[model samples]
Target: MEIKFEQKIPVLLEKAGKKGMTYKELSIKCKAKKEEGKYFRLAVQKCKAAGLILEKKGKFFATQSKGLYPAVIKRLHKTYGFAERLEQKDEVFILGSKLKGALAGDKVMIRLSKHTRGNLPEGEVISFIEAGEVEFTGIAHLTKGGPFITPDDIGNFDLRLEGSVKGVADGDKVTAKITKRGQGHRDLRAKVVKSFGQATRAAACCEAILNLNGVTPEFPPQVLEEAKFLAQRGIKHKELLNREDLRNEVIFTIDGADSKDLDDAISLSKYQDFYILGVHIADVSYYVREKTALDEEALRRGTSIYYANKVVPMLPKELSNGICSLNPDEERLAFSAIMTLSKDGKLLDYDFKKSVICSRVKGVYSEVNEIIAGTAGKEILAKYRDVLHVIPLMKELSDILHHNRKLRGAPDIDTAESKLILDENDRIVDIVPRQRGEAEEMIEEFMLTANEAAATLAKKLQIPFVYRVHEYPDGEKLNVLKETLQALGLPAREIKGNVPSKVLSDILDEAKGKPFYPIVSRQVLRSMAKAKYSETPIGHYGLALENYAHFTSPIRRYPDLTIHRILSDVVTQKRSASDIKKRYSEFVGRSANASTEAEISAMKVERDCEDCYKAEYMEDHVGESFDGMITSVTSFGFYVGLPNTVEGLVRIEALPEGQYQYDGLMELKETHTGNAFRVGDAIRVTCSGVDVNAGNIDFVPAEPESDENG
Candidate 1:
């Protein structure tokens, strides 16, 4: 009987597990004929490549290790692929061909591709695991042989269909289910699941984003039915018997003018030389009980995704915008955090309870900002007279909290984000920069206090819980920061050991008022580790807190919802029993993992949409020149950021003709003219083509045209 090389390796590897084998001994054990020695040797190599067997000191042994690990495909370099931001290790290196059709942000199971002498083990993707699940929206073509779908971006390979074409024509855009994979790139295919209208249209772009990210833009029928039923079912009178009645408290919610899915409200009271601050978060858990369709849907979503003109709400709007919302003058269910704090913002004590709160007013951030600025119109000031007196007190507390946070080494990296305004037709009307004002900051401070209070309580109880953690930056990154500072002619401060966040914060303060402050701030941010959900308390480095949990925004973030459920169980039950502890122990682990994954995925979706919106806005501005700063440098080119935060690349070839090389500081220097362009350098650039499908905006260097000439 003859076995193929692929088949022969598994048998040899299984046998090798019992005892280590030398190549000569393995050849003898294989019982292969002289002609099959090369084939047998090839089989051994295959086994090694798949990481099923390992050779140490010239003896082969079965690894007995399921080397499968989920890795993020960050970038594809020549002949090699890189897996970065992995939970298992710092990074996993992969052979390019062994990628098995993976792209950036794709989650995949990988094993060792090969282990060579004096080199780190490289990996190969064995399977593409679903982040949630894979579905691509793209344009499809009907060929004579069969119909195939091509993703709008990302995957360049056409997905061949097994059957006949559907309603989608040759040039039509469609969404599909990835039913099967071909052995090679050419054979990969999917079934046409749904069809959209045309490409580049408003609906088509939105549909493509939702499908590609595996985000359902609407709630399921059953989930909607549940929400509608609950909306009609008012809170039972008996349910309020034991709850704290805060209906008389001077409580109100502050949000954007157009906001409706309000989930948190704030109240304040005077208490002899101190202040009583109350943060009332919507009691979403009361309505969304465990195992229900509503609860399942919310967990699956993980978080809401907001776009230029749309929002994919985590919960059905009937609840998020209805009964669960803390609208003004309405009595609503809430999980309240009542804190007593001194004038200097020291939390003396806090109490948590299920409460019924009647909010006095619904305030807008813009109007409240006006009040703080002393520019509020008489009518606007009068409208908010009930809460106007407390606004100044809120600011006083906010300043104290902010000062204490800074003293504890938490830096406030305040950077403005872009807000793409869309017209009714979904076309980009304008792109504006949105900056947080006093009103927003005060609310943020109060919410942070509430979150901190809840986290402290959870830790005190010593129960299983998930904490939001931002770990300290590694030494190598601080070294890079040191280099960046040196390049900027700022002090290259040496970090002795595990440096405090204040050290970095001080460096950022030095960069203040500089033209490249944004670049420096952003680069430092990139050097820091991502904040994630963890079952264990490692402290939040960014917040400089020993304990922290997300107790706010339960209507949107699943982590907050999970926290609420835990608090409900622990507080209501009056003790963490064995059953409850075991249940939450499992929940803490599973939810942390799933929720972190979901949060990252949702962030990617948001970034992708932001890029799309930027491209849409820039499409009409071709040939227009604007002043921008060089924000990034790569071998291909450098990216320039406009004032509004839109970044476009200036390719190396487009630079003033010369051979440019990357300096030690990552600046591209021209050999002939000796002109050097590094990050933070201000340059003028003309608008270039916008590749919407690829989410790229290209720019060429030029001097801005004078207004008189125009």
Candidate 2:
């Protein structure tokens, strides 16, 4: 077989060694005719442009000789960018001049420079390998050279539009496709393809954000058809063959009152010292079979994104909220994990089975908490009368499990999560901190037990499966935590060296009920690594669990669905360990990676979209003074979070005219007045300004009472 000229040029150049060869000499070696000479020259040029071959003083050599590394542009700032080396730990900092028009997420080859900015190595882009995003969503402005777009992600740079943009007026949020690639930001050209309404509206900004993240509430026609068919089919009698029937059991689901995708349900029974806890998860894998349209779409989505009042589900509502949902009194297919645990919450033994269950009632968390608190109204009591006997047992088991978690030294780090209360017109009327009550914690503990059991079974069987893993925190972040604690005059003794979960737990315990408890909790959370899905069971640090997997919420989470798919073969099909491993070994790794990426994307979308909603709400509250605590301090400003979970930045300019020095972690001190504003400090601030499109809220000190130290 003859090699294509483009492919052959790189191989031939590489084989020529460090001595290199001239273009004319290479052409002669190929014995190219006059007509074929032009094609050979083109191949050489392509190879050189691709960073496969380098030309120095008319001599050609492979790029390896010059030590060019392939990297992905991780982030781009106004004047600089950082490229993370592929499959490597190091990141290269590229100045604006060295970037060579590379954008964030682009793959490129770079030549390392001798210079270094602190510990980061400096590099220059040599050649492009692949373009990351050809389209971007941003606010368009009418410039002298037609309309230009200022992208949401890329800062301070305007992308010039090619030709005239008809419908995209000034301040309209639009998505533009790159029409011409360039060697610099100034040369890049794009055309507006679509536009949301005015950028000033939070709704318009949110739509663009959702589009940019590839999140949609709409399902494809094929996936919808598949879901519709499965919903209509419902549960067939023949499909229940060889499955355990627990339809008569007093099992029920507990979720938010407005939640539609009810997936996991539970039942509890006390037998002397052991509690037979039944966790029945909606068997989504049965309906969303492998390689089907519904399954593919779910895998692509990975997890449902919930922002404000809306949700972008992983699966269609036909499955998520219809037949596959564990609705009250509905006989639904389920994967049941019946665990026999000691009264002290120790897992004695567990059984995983393909089962059918009829949830007796839809249990609301608030109502369950009221029952436990003896605060339930007559209506609430009557609603839960059927499963009222099991509520106390759940509370008892939850207390035992909570004690077990505390004993195992799992840090109880809590962050303030906001719930945007939207009006009928979808405008935010209030932003309140979402509180997790005892009922929520009980459900969480129950889910954790089932997840651990699932992972334990996979490990016991030695089968390939996805595990929810959270590795230990980085040593550098721990050091920062130690310094911050010491600076705050808190105990830093246990934060040294290899810190355990118990030490952090102790720190939080000491800080509990203190004015700075929120900041301490936030700092501890910041010091921990993010929990993600993995094929390898490395353990979860936050939960202090050795074995864990997402075995619940298969209706919304792809990782849970993946777990169900693998376990179905083991429990339902009764497949051998060897067979299961052979079938899913490679598939688990791919699923884990895809699930993690999708989860990250969903989280970003949720956070960004929620910020816009919050900003929109704050727009109506400008000029109002509110007492808030400093959650974090940056060089430019300190972020103040109100009790309602509304956070705004107190910019450095808003402070008294003085030089302010940032301690680099959480404190900002006015050099002149010796007044220090640190994380956890309380202050009264007035909402000064808000940029709804950018989701930025600005605050200023209120009156004479500005800074209040904790």
Q: Return the TM-score for candidate 1, rounded to 2 decimals.
A: 0.85
Superposed on all Cα atoms, model 2 deviates from the true structure by an RMSD in Å of: 3.6
Task: Give the top-scoring candidate (TM-score).
Answer: 2
Model 1 weakest lDDT span, ten residues long: 127-136
Give the per-residue Cα lDDT of candidate 1 at 338. Answer: 92
- Cα deviation at 579, candidate 1, in Å, is 5.0
Provide the TM-score for each candidate, comma-separated: 0.85, 0.92
lDDT of each: 0.80, 0.87
Of the candidates shown, which would achieve the greatest lDDT relative to the real structure?
2
lDDT of 2 by residue, 641-693 (tens): 99998889999999988999998888899998999998888899999999888
